[model samples]
Target: MIRPFAALLALAALFSAPVLAAPAADAAATPSWSIAIHGGAGTLQRKNMTAEEEKAYRAALAAALDAGAKVLAEGGEALDAVEAAIVLLEDDPRFNAGRGAVFTWEGTNELDASIMDGRTRAAGAVAGVTTVRNPIRLARSVMDDGRHVFLSGAGAERFASQRGLEPAGPEWFATERRRRQLETMKAERVGALDVEFKFGTVGAVARDQAGHLAAGTSTGGMTGKRWGRIGDAPVIGAGTWADDRSCAVSATGWGEFFIRAGVAQAICDRVRLAGEGVQQAADTVIGEVAAMGGDGGVIVVSAEGETVYSFNTAGMYRGRADSTGTREVAIFAGD
Candidate 1:
């Protein structure tokens, strides 16, 4: 029989004994994951939008973020989450992409899209495609099935059709608001400006539980664009690029500078080679490549579940949601 003092000592010892912590769970089992998205980049302002219009933009952004977060929570690949989020924006007319894309000089709508798988360095893109409803989906399909890296024009449309992608009439993409915007730009003689409106495209980058990275970009092409102009959207390194060892980047801005600098891939390369943080690498690229003579912004997601969004413009339509339920959305730089 233990004395009262002895019993008290045993209790103290038991309480003080190293509470054996459960074995640390696998990182994959408790993956550190995140999702980020952008509507586009440019001079977004409150004066340029009405209350209802702002609400629409917010709602659209929220919806996209929700979709992406859901995918990440389900152990989906980053590519799937990014694409799922972007498709919502692509299908919405509130932005200049997919179903609501801007018109070309010939009064026709042209679309561009790209997707990159960080794990494989595999990418696909479509340019000057007029009939496909969802160009990004078609791009992914190409990456998965076709041997080609890029497809353009009527040929791309044919390939999309062969792949069972839905085709729509040209009228299906037109919007009175967009037409007026084009007319206004033309009137101001600034239609040729280097994508200052920020109405470029939708992009997403994600890191998943499986330690994978992916990126995607979808655009209606440049506003009031001419001569079969293809922006960086379809140029893998320029507009969209990803690599698991580095980071995934999606760019929105002056297509010419983006293409010349390989904005997306350049950011990734900086991280892989220089060991820069996601924000540092992204800022360096944007300032060097995009802000040199061009104008625009980008969203980046690193392998460690870090996100960086930087732009020179007044604002960029952007949002982010992480595994910890941190959800935030913005339209302007200040937002």
Candidate 2:
């Protein structure tokens, strides 16, 4: 039997013991699997959108989410999950990717895409390719081909043909909406295109049951872009990046600024080296881009299954899903 004072001291010691006072279970649990995606980021205001248009965009985003979520739910690889989702967006004429890519100064549609696999630290990209039906698929082919990390222009088209990838006719890519946008840009005759016209890149990031991470981005480049310009979408570490030890990221915004800031990789680096949470790292990176006068957004997923959608613009078409059957889609800033 201890004295009252001794008992009180013992209680304090027990409470202070490191083992008994061990930190609470990590709030950021390693999820079984998770995925996040973004369609584009820009001045997407409610006034500029009709109810029907908003509904269509939301439906498309949901479809993409379902495509990727299905793969993840079935225990597929993260790489496969990202590819599945992006392919859907690429085919949808509503987004500026494969089927609905923007036109170049030459009146041709040039698509760009990149993909990264964190488990193997492998990546592949294609830029200024006009004929690949789905540029994301070609990017994956390049990665699996194992001979090159990037391909561009006629070479990329030739490689895709050689690899038996489907070839898309120019008509298949040119939508009336994009053609009208090009006319508008030409009429403006301005060197700097508007952010609204430059939006509509599609991207996805995922973590699989095996704990591997992956990211992919696809875009039609900029409207009225010329001189064989290539944006960040096809540049590894700029528009897209992934690492099993850090996180995966996909960016959609002004390509030039994103390239300059290394937006995607910067977010992952903050998480990997600075010990920042996924949301915090993404917020910091997007803020840095905004400070540089760049408007865009990014989707990030940590190794522990944390997901973040960070943007500096008025809105970003985005969505998320997990193996637990939770799914959400939003386009406005607050939603």
Backbone clashes per model, in order?
Answer: 3, 0
- Per-candidate TM-score against the hidden true structure: 0.88, 0.90
Task: Summarize candidate 2's per-residue lDDT along 15-117 as a digit string, tens digits.
Answer: 1211111111344445699999889877677888999999999999999999998898889999999999999999999899999988888899999999999
Relative to the unseen true structure, what is the C-alpha lDDT of residue 252 in candidate 2, on a scale of 0 to 100?
91
RMSD (Cα, Å) of model 1: 17.5
Which pairs clash inside model 1?
41-198, 42-198, 315-333
lDDT of 1: 0.81
User: Model 2 compared with the native: what TM-score?
Assistant: 0.90
- Per-residue lDDT tens digits of candidate 1, residues 148-243? 989999999999989998888888788887777677666665553322356578999999988899999999877788899998988999999999
